[model samples]
Target: MQVEMQDIHKAFGKNQVLTGVHFELLPGEIHALMGENGAGKSTLMNILTGLHQADRGTILINGKERSFSSPKEAEQNGMAFIHQELNVWPGMTVLENLFLGRELKNGFGFLKMKEMKALAKEQFERLDVDIPLEQEAGLCSVGQQQMIEIAKALMVNAEVIIMDEPTAALTDREIAKLFEVIDTLRKQGVSIVYISHRMEEIFTICDRITVMRDGQTVDTTKIADTTFDEVVKKMVGRELKDRFPARAASLGEVALEVRNFTRKGAFENISFSVRAGEIVGVSGLMGAGRTEIMRAIFGLDRMDSGELYRNGKKIKVHSPGEAVKHGIGLITEDRKDEGLILDFSIRHNIALPNVEGLSSKGFIDGKEEQQFVEDLIKRLTIKTESAETSAGNLSGGNQQKVVLAKWIGTNPDVLILDEPTRGVDVGAKREIYALMNELTDRGVAIVMVSSELPEVLGMSDRVIVIHEGKLSGELSREEATQEKIMTLATGGE
Candidate 1:
C-alpha cells in the first residue's frame, strides 16, 4: 500500500494537536517518523489508523482517496497499528491474544480450535518467535510480548503497519530478531511506518525520514542525505547542545548503602553504595533484576534479607511512606501505573508527597500548594496548559517531567531513578541529564537504573552491571565502554 496523508488538521477542544501535517509511506519501504513527544507524530498516525478523525485532511491509498471509520476497518483494509504500549491481554494465552476478536469458528458457531492453533503456529514460525501457544501472555517476558504483537499484525496480512516505539521494551537480541522480521516484511512488499526516539535504530533501519515539529512537517529526506544533527534540529526547532550534560564530580560520604539484599526469584545478595554528589548507574538487560533491586530499596517489594543504611545509619523501610520519611525517593520505571495517577491534576500529583509542607494544621493551603507546583513546573519546563490540567493529557516527555517534579518536591537525600529517559526525546533527555547534574551538585545521591548503555556511560560517575539477579561487574567512568558493559551485562568476566 502507498499511503499519503496530506494537510492533516486535528484538535481537541482548545488544543490543536496536528496542524497541516503531511506524511507519506511507500510500499516495501521503512519510513521513520521522527519528532519530540507531543510534536503531532502520534496524532497523525492515529488519524491514519482511524483512531481519530481529522477535522481537515486528505488520505490517499494507492492514489485513491480513502478514510477508515474505525481501526478494525483500517486493519481489514491492510493497515495495522502496533502501539508503544503493548495491548496484549495478560490473562489470555498467546494464541488467544493473537486471534482475540477475530477467532475462527465453524458455521455452527462452534470454535475451530485446531484451525486457529495451526494458523497461529504458522505465523509464529514465520516471525521466528519461540513462545509457546498456550503460555499466558502476561507470563511472557517484555521481549516475547513484543514479538507476539508483531506476529499478530502479520497474521492480519497487513500491507501497511505503523509500529510506535516497537523496540522500547526489547533487548539487543530481541531487537535484532525484530529487525530480521522487518527485513523479511520489506522483501515481501509491506510498508512500515517506524516511530521511535532511538536515532541509531532509525538511521540503521529506515530508508527515509520525516521530521515533525509542533504539529507540522519540517522536513522529509532520505536517510543518506540527512545527518543526525539535522534531523534533531528539525524535530526540536533548535540546536541541541549536548546529548548529555557535562558535570564535575566532588565525592562525599556514602549516602545510601544496600547490604546483602536478597529477593528470591528477583535479585539475590545485591550490595551497592552511592555517595553524596554522585550518580551510580545500574546497567543491565531487560529483566536483569535492576528494577527489582530499586523497588526493594523503595519498599515496593519485600527483601528476603537485606540491610539499608542512610548517611551511615541503619534504616527500615516497610512501605513507601517509610522510605520517604527516611529521605528516599523513587521514580518508578512503569510510570503510568506506579508513578502518576492519570486522573489527578499536576498540582495534586506533585503535592501527593509534599502535602505536609503544603498543609497547615491538616488544612490545605491552596496558595502555598499552587506556588510549589508552579515553581516545579517552571523549573522542569513542563509543557502543559496549566497545573490543573490532567496528567494523563500530557505527552510522554512532559509526563516524565511531572514525575520528576513529584520527586523533586520531596527533597530526598537519596533518589532512585529507573529508566529516567526511556521514552523521552533527545532534547528532554539532555534536560533530564542537566537536572541530574544539578541534583548531584546539591549533594544528592542518585541510583540510576537504565537499559540504554550510552546513558549509563554518559551520566554515571560509576557503572554497575546486573545479570540474572546478581551484580555482574562494576566499572568506573573511564573504564566503561559499550563492549565492556555488554560483556559484563551478558555474564562474561
Candidate 2:
C-alpha cells in the first residue's frame, strides 16, 4: 500500500505542532521520520494514524482519498500504529492482549480461548519469537512485550505500520532480534514508518530518511547520499559539534559512600563512592543491579543490609523523605511515571521538592512559590507556557528539563540520574550534558547509570561496570573504552 499525507497543518491552542508538513511511505520500504522532541514528529504521525485530525491536510491511500475517524478505521484499511510507550496491559496474558480488540468468538457469544491461543502462538512462530503465550504480559520483559505488539500488527495484515522508538528500552541483543523481524517484514512488501532519535539505528534499518524541524519538513534524502553530520545539522539547524559537554576540571572529597549494600538476589556487597564535582557512570547490562543500587540509595527500594555515608558520616535512609532531607535527589528512569506527576503544572513539580521552604505551618506562600519557579525555569531553559502548563503537555525533552528543575531546586549535594537521555533528541541531549557540567562545576556529586555506551564514555569522569549484581571493575576516564566496559559488564577479569 502507498500512503501520502500532503500539506498537513495542526495546532493545539497557541502551539503550532505541524505546519504544512508532507510525508509519504512507499510499499515495502523502511522510511525513517527523524526529528528532535517538539519538532512535530509525533503530531504528524498522530494525524496519519487517525488519533488526531489535522486542521488542514489531505491524505491519499493508493490514489484514493480517505479520512479515518478512529484507529480501528486505520487498522481496517491496512495501517497500524505502534506507540513509543508499550500499550500492553500488565494484568492480561499475552494471548489475551494479542486478540483484545478483535477476539475470536464462539457460537454461544463466549470468547474462543483455544482459537486465540493457537493464533497467537502461530504469530509468534511466524515472527521467530519464543514467548510464553499464557504468561501475563506484565511479567514479560520489555523486549518480549514489544515483539507481541509487532505480532498484533501482523495479525491484522497491516501493510503500513508506524513504529515510534521501538528500541528505546531494548538491550543490544533484543535490538538485533527486532532488526531481523523488521527485515522479514520488509521482504513481505510491508511498508514501515520507523521513528527514532538514535542515529546509528536510523542508518542501519532505514532506506530513506526525512528530517523535521520546528513543525516543518526540512529535507528528505537517501541513506547512501547523505552523511550523519549532514542529517544532524538538518535536524537542529546548528553547527556540528560534540554531543557530550566537557567534564569537570577537578574533584573534591568523597561526598557519598555505600559499603556492603546487600539486597539478596537483587544485589550483594555493592560498594561505590562519588567525589564532589565528579560524574560517575554506572555501566551494566539489563538486570545488572545498576538501577537497584540507585533505588536503594534514594530510599525507593530497601536494602537488606548496607552502610550509607554522607560527607563521611554514616546515615540511614528508611524512606524517600529522609533521602531528600539528607540533600539527595533522584531523577528516575521513567519521567512520566516516577519523576513527575503528569497532571500537575511545571511550577508545582519544581516546587514539590521545596514545599517546606515555600510553606509555613502547612500554608504555602504563593508569591514565594511563583518567584522560585520562575527563576528556576529560566535558569533551566524549560520550554513551558509561563510555568502554568501541565508536565504531561510538554514535549519529551522539555519534560526532562522540568524533571531536572525539580531536582535542582532541592539543593542536593548528591544527584542520581538513571537513563537521563533514553528517548530524548540530539539537541536536548547536548543541553542535558551541559547542565551536568554546570552542576558538577559547583561541586555537586553525580552518579549516572546509562545503557548507551557512547553516553557512558563521553560524559563520565569515572566508569564503573557491574555484572550479575556485583561490581565488576572501575576505570578512570583516560583508561575507559567501550570494549573494556563491555568486557567488565560481561564478567571479564
Candidate 3:
C-alpha cells in the first residue's frame, strides 16, 4: 500500500490551511507526519481521508489517481483514520463496536453475533490486547479503548491507517503495548501514517518523517538522517531558544490553598498552595489523580472532605459558576470536548462565561458581547478570520487560544490549567507559556498539571508530585530534576 499527495491546497473560507504540500508513504513502512498545530497536518489528513475536499490536490494510491467523496468511501478503499478522540460506542460491548457499521448477516437477515466475536478476538490477538468481548467500551481504560479503536480499523481490512496522536492518553505501559502493536502492523505489511508531537516516538517507530510548516512541506527524510532539534526547527521555522518561558519574577501572597482534600477513591489528602505571581506545576504519571485534584478545587468534582482558601479567606466552590464568581477559572483538558462548544462561533463561545456581564436587563447585549469577543481575539492573538467563525473551523492551537481567552474573560485571581499544551504545536506552546508569564506577573496565580517533565521543571516555580492520588513530595525549581520527579511519581520519598 502506498499514498502520495501532490500539490495539496485546502482552505476554509479565507483561512488557507494547507498549501502545495506533498507527502508520500511507502508500503509496510510507518511514516510520520510532523508539524506544529494548525501547520496543515490535520488539513492534509482530512483531504486524504475524505472528511474534507482539497480545493487543489491529487491523491494517488499505488500509482493510481483516486477520488474519494466521503469517509466511508475512503475506508472502503482501505484507508482508515483512527482519530485522537476514540470513536467507539461506549454503551456497546467491544464485539458490537467492532462490527458496528459493517455487521455480517445471514441469508435470513439474522445478526452474526458469534462470527463478530470471533473476528474481534482475532483482531485483539493480532494487537496482543486482552479485552473481554462482552465488556462495555466505556468501562475499559483509555489505553484499552484506544487499542479497540485500532482493532476497529483493522476489522475494516484497512491497509493504510492514519493514527492521530494515538498515545496521548496512554500510560507508559500502555505506550509500550501500542508500540509493539505498531511494530506488528508494519511487519504485517500495513502502511501507517503516524502523527504525534512526541519526537522520541518518531525516532523509535517511524521509518520516514515528513514535516509541514505554515501550510507548506518543509522536507521529508529518513529517521536516521535527522536530529530532534533539526525536526523542530523545520516544524516551527525557528530554533527554539527556550522551550518554556522564564519562571515568575517573585511569589506574592497565597492566592489559593487546598488542605487535606479528599475525594473518595479519586484522590486523598491532596494539599497544595499557589502564591500570587507564581506558577506551581503538578506532575504525576497517568491516573495519579493530577486532574482529579484540580477538578475538585475548581468545583468540577465534589470533594468528600477538603478546605479551600483563597487569599486566606475560606470559600465554598459548589459549582463552576461559583468558582467563576469567586475569581477562579479553569482551562480544562480535552479542549475540543470540554472547553469549547464546537457548534458555537468563537464570539459566542468566548461570551458564554461572561454572559452575566455581557447582558443588559436579562437579555444579552449583542454589541457588548461582540466587542468583548473582538477584544479577546486581538489580545490572545487567536487566528480566526473573524469572531463569527465557528470554533470548529479553527486549528488545534487556535482552539486552545479560544479556551484560554474564554477563561481569562472571567478575570480570575487563580487559574488552573490541565495539560494546557497537550496536542498543540511548538509555536503555540511558546505563546501560551508567554501568556502564563504575563498572567502571573499581573498577580494571577496558576496551577499547571503537566505530563511533560521538561515543562514541569522549566516553567514552574515549585513542583508538586502525586503518587496514586496522594501527595508524594514537593521540590523547588532548583531541586526539581527529571530523576527527582520520577522518583516521587513512582512512590519514592
Q: List, residue by residue over 8-109, the lDDT tens digit for candidate 2.
A: 999999988899999888899999999888899988888887889999989999978888888888999899998776789889988888998899998999
Q: Any residue pairs clashing in model 3, and if so which?
A: 37-425
My TM-score estimates for the predictions, one after another, are 0.96, 0.95, 0.93
The per-residue C-alpha lDDT of model 2 at residue 383 equals: 69
Find the 10 residues in a row with the least total lDDT in model 1: 138-147
What shift in Å separates residue 319 of candidate 3 from its native position after superposition?
A: 0.7
| RMSD list, candidates in order | 1.6, 1.9, 2.3
Q: Model 3, 139-256: lDDT tens per residue?
A: 7756678888888987887889999988877766668877887888899999999999888889999999999988999999999999989998999888988777766367799999
Using alpha carbons, what is the TM-score of model 2? 0.95
lDDT by candidate, in order shown: 0.91, 0.88, 0.88
Error of 1 at 296 (Å): 1.1
lDDT of 1 by residue, 243-342 (tens): 8889798989999999999989999999999999999999989889898899899999889998999999999998999999999999987677689998
Q: Model 3's lDDT to the true fold?
A: 0.88
- Candidate 2 regions off by >4 Å? 122-131, 134-136, 139-148
In candidate 2, the residue pairs with backbone N, CA or C atoms under 3 Å apart (3 or more residues apart, or in different chains) clash, namely: none
Sorted on TM-score, best first, the list reads 1, 2, 3
